[model samples]
Target: MTSEKRESALGALQSNLKKGHVYRREDLLISSNAVDRHLKQLLKSGVLEKLSQGLYYAPKTSIFGRLPPKEDDLVRAFLKDEEFLILSPNTYNSLGLGTTQLHNKTSVYNHKRHGVFKMGNRSFEFRIKPRFPKKLDKEFLLVDLLNNLNSLPENKDVILANIKKMLTNFDLIKLEKYVLLYGVVRTKKTVLSLLHDLR
Candidate 1:
């Protein structure tokens, strides 16, 4: 490609990279040669930040420093789809339960990509669950918290008891529905037992 064509392609590509948005090479739909040249130029000029292979983002700058794109945006670029949920065990701590331990890993419940993946400066634990919430909800979080209880480094009985107490404060109907639909068999059993105790 001529210098004019390369510059034109780069301009077009840059036009599409909205700030705080993550992108993939294929999303540009430009010829491979031109796309690569343009991307290299953009990267060299600090206009675009490459997160990984074929994935890039237009950083959001702040007074502190350059802010990375949202986790969901990065995951979308990694998975190439919006059908995934990113969560962390630390979310469980927000329930006011007695558990106070901090967790460093973030979990990605996605259909594709099963295993841990290092994206940028963070690590994501990808799990392929048959069913996962399209969006995060308290009810779903309660259910998921129960579902992964066994894997947590805490006292199971104590957590269950705490969850039992916590259940009384949530919407019973929604919690029940989430347990039956999104929760595993063990979680269902625990939730059912807790509900039965309330009745």
Candidate 2:
């Protein structure tokens, strides 16, 4: 009788969740008594993939087999909120500032959860910041690059020189605004000195 109920509950759950969509354990609306058993059954059957504790997703299979869940989906489920920004030091490589080293970690800027979080076999360094841009932009990236300069494994003076040269091509007004809004004390000071040189 309990097995029958679990089977019925699993069927209802499978029908409700669309493929490739991540669902938190709390997202289930069924009675809580057998929810754990139902999830275990589903996992054993390969109908769902357990991403982490309390997080599951209906597998999206392809010719290559099952695909991993999207990073945004994992983050949304983990944070239980959509307000966050994802970035990586690798972004700095595109700026042509001579930063050739590759980094494995990603940074998640948000108001909540300040610590490292593991998502789908990847590490995300969550930083609690007072302010962050809704979307990444070149000017903002420049400011962030300087903000994390000391952390990067690179020659700082060379990178700073390259950035100083590049700033002349950027919109001074917008760059200044980004500096004020998101730049750390060290970053702001450096940008201000560069802007003064530009004048």
Candidate 3:
């Protein structure tokens, strides 16, 4: 492709791209004179941001500066699947379970990928689990807190005691359901033990 044709192709490709929308390499092929060349130039010129192996994003900018891609969008593109759930440790603080430590990382539970991945400035800790809720609820949160208690920075013994007291605040059926469904063996024992103590 000649330089003029390349520029025209690039411009055409650019026109089709919407800021903050992500694209895959194959998705851009039909619109490019030379896909690789166009991608290289676009990256060099800061027009496109590489997300993962084949993912590229047209970033959105604001007065503060360039904006990071939305978490759901980033994870969806990275996993190439929409079946995923994002949970932040910061959210657990709302449970009033004495989980006050701040956490910067977000956990992604999905069937496709397992391990940490960095996209732009954020790091996602991907965990492969057989089951996860489509949306978060307090019942699920409490169960999850027990499931991951060992990894948390707070005092586990006190947190477990706190969890025991907060049981009445949640739906028992749902809470027990999540514990049976999502809890590890240790978590199951802990929750069961707590319930036994209550009785």
Candidate 4:
């Protein structure tokens, strides 16, 4: 029977997810229709939650009843596809770096704007910016640091110290390469000088 099969499938999924890991829809299904129906049933029953349209997770329950991971983590988990990355306004706030005046909306960037996705109480606004630096190399890293700096408290010493620490781990050559490629002149100058002093 369809009901029996669905129950069996849900059980299998629940068992696998008991390890506290997240799984993508495709990874859990041999047939798409089966996944679709089963996911709908589970979501309705509150046995599973829709993190994103195609992404779902088993909620963690506590004395508070159900406790979800922070918004950023939920977004990141839902965005397991490498083509997209989650960029929440509270990314810095979630990481204890800053306070976010906007909590209801989060932004994400990849290569294309994928529209918006709403999951439970939150809504995510997705957009595509130019690709991030190839890896976490210095130049791109500085851009990331600067981009997230508004999250930090307004303390000059703390800001400079954080900058110095971030610079210490940078690759000057790669930084310069991206600086030239991206025309990030201000960051280029600041990082180059810092690298010179650190050397």
Off by over 4 Å in 1: 1-5, 31-33
List CA RMSD, all candidates.
Answer: 1.9, 1.8, 1.8, 5.9
The worst-scoring run of ten residues by lDDT in candidate 3 lies at: 190-199
Better of 2 and 4 by lDDT: 2
Which candidate should be chosen as best, given TM-score against the real structure?
2
Compared with the true structure, what per-residue lDDT tens digits does model 2 show for residues 166-191? 87877889999999999989999999
**Candidates, ranked, lDDT:** 3, 2, 1, 4
Candidate 1: 10-residue stretch with minimal lDDT: 28-37
lDDT of 4 by residue, 113-165 (tens): 57787766677777666766433333554555455455545563565566677
lDDT of 3 by residue, 133-168 (tens): 999999888888878888899998888778888878
Q: Report the number of clashing residue pairs per model.
A: 0, 0, 0, 0
Q: Where in model 3 is the C-alpha error above 4 Å?
A: 193-199
RMSD of 3: 1.8
Judge candidate 2 at residue 150 and give its lDDT.
Answer: 93
lDDT of 4: 0.60
Candidate 4 segments whose C-alpha is farther than 4 A from its true place: 2-6, 19-24, 31-33, 69-80, 83-107, 112-116, 123-125, 133-141, 144-178, 181-199
Estimate candidate 2's alpha-carbon lDDT, on a 0 to 1 scale: 0.85
Residue 178 shift from truth in candidate 3, angstroms: 1.3
